[model samples]
Target: MTFKHALMAATLAALVGNAFAAEDRMPPIPADKLSDAQKKSIELLSEGAPAGGAPRNVGAGPWVPLLRSPELLNRLQRMGSYLRYESAFDPRLSEFVILLTARDWSNQYEWLAHQKLALKAGVTPAVTQAIAEGRRPTGMTADEEMVYDFIDELLRNRSVSDPTYARIKDRFGERGVIDLIAINGYYSMLAAVLNVAQSPLPGGAPQQIPTLPR
Candidate 1:
């Protein structure tokens, strides 16, 4: 296939939606057929997807699939839902960890999405701006403080220190701590994928993230 043809195929594959397996593609979704929310989602993703014009080689294989694959996507989305229902940390805390992971891996697109969500989740505008700028949030709540500290430990040590883990264990009890680790690890893998893919950020995406320390 010509380069242009290949790029078209990739974009169409994404635009087609993968709410399930890519093999079991979504039926043709007409613009007019979509509800307002669904239509807006389609429009945003369509506008932001990479051009696919010149694919780059990274690591041993491709990276975007790990982000878009239905099985993994379902599993990961469940983590967000579970957090929303069962945890001390709110979605804003989740967003804080996501921003930390994205900044750590230099993944611009990840930062963009989570920053927007963090704000919507009631994270203060100043904190989102701070996170986007790669600085600490000015005053994260108690739960956010726990999450940020845990993430800082995880990235630095690749595992939380006994002290930090013990704190989370006490704060969240056993299951919550485990879920916290699972959630952070999930985002860590995601950040690595976006970094490896060199995922393109949306146009008008914030370009102001600070440079994380090496």
Candidate 2:
């Protein structure tokens, strides 16, 4: 082959390689081609979305894969709505649990969505930073510390210790305890969905959660 032709071919090959490397792990299902079930899921999600619109990530988020089973998606959406908007725990505490779950899963998209909300809901910067770095945060309020410890143990040990259970039970009551566990389980499920799908952050967003070193 001629030298010029060889160089051009090599350059084209390099560009294709780069594009493939950067491609999304799970590309979102295109809106135009959605199944009836998928379309219904979007409609339900849009209805419940906070005032302006559905979250940017919803199109690419777990909801997409979940579209395969609209019934399951519907139930999850209702449960998620309650956990996020109507839970007995205050927004701050709810957001804290979300961040913890996001970090545990190394879920970049979940972290990107919740990190700011977590701050707005009053989780301190120090605590968020520490969680992102896989360390126990300093200066937690009594309630925050109890929650952090409870979730940490639950995730690591798969069950709370007697003392941890007693402490939370005393402070939050039986219903609150149930809600806490529900929130943890719900968000953990979301983390798994996002991780499995390799969901991407919204355009131009950076990955806020760093993967922890083994």
Candidate 3:
């Protein structure tokens, strides 16, 4: 396996092994136990979610840890609203970036939640599967390839190379690039929260990402 693949394998193995034990690291904040600030955070988060209600409880998932800082949670929720619904890129492209971020972090909750949305957003099975397997996906359009490369370089290097930057900037312009980076950074933060929280997939939901070759 390549270095990236090997690293991913190691990370996944560690996370999988600790899955059960990590649960207590950050327990959910019960509604009755929520501070006034946390309640306000939930209200903002819920409003930013879909019209019906938030996909998951604000007291659950990554939101649990973030609840400790209600102001931060509120800001994050607003940023998340824009990235998810109002970004310059298409929803499919946004989802692609999120999936790659999810995989890089080996964040089970992130991967599980976005896998279906990625598919619905038209990220092909081949691309998602290849990413899950830690290989560069095949048969992506120029746009997909550009997005993949940009995200890949950013994750691996902490900055994009000049050529990659120019290509995306030319095609997407400054606002698009900013939005792209924002999505990646935001989701990565959420991944960290989820990882630390040891948030599991809902009940019996199967893990979508497989363990990579060690």
Tens-digit lDDT string for candidate 1 (1-214) = 6544654564455444322322312232454665565444333333422322122222112123442343554455445445534555556666666777777765655676667777877788887766555556767787777777888788778888888888788888887687777666776777666555544443434333533334
Better of 1 and 3 by TM-score: 3
Query: Best candidate, TM-score-wise?
Result: 3
Location of the lowest summed lDDT over 10 successive residues in candidate 3: 47-56
Per-residue C-alpha lDDT of model 2 across residues 1-214, encoded as one tens digit per residue: 6544654564465456434544455666787878898788778877754423245345766776677678898899888878887777988999999999888887776788888998998999999988887778999989999999999999999999999999889998988889999999998898887677666666756556545533
* RMSD of each predicted structure: 13.9, 9.9, 3.1
Clashes of each: 1, 0, 0
Among all windows of 10 consecutive residues in model 2, the one with the lowest summed lDDT is 48-57
CA lDDT for candidate 2: 0.79
The superposed Cα distance between candidate 1 and the true structure at residue 132, in angstroms, equals 3.1
lDDT of 3 by residue, 1-214 (tens): 6767685776677577656544547667777988998888787776646533235566456887888889998888778877887788888999999999988887778888788888998999999988887789999989999999999999888999999999899999999899989999999999988877767666656666754553
Candidate 2: stretches off by over 4 Å: 1-25, 49-57
lDDT of 1 at 197: 52
- Candidate 3 deviation (Cα RMSD): 3.1
Those runs of model 3 whose alpha carbons end farther than 4 Å from true positions after fitting are 1-21, 48-56, 211-214
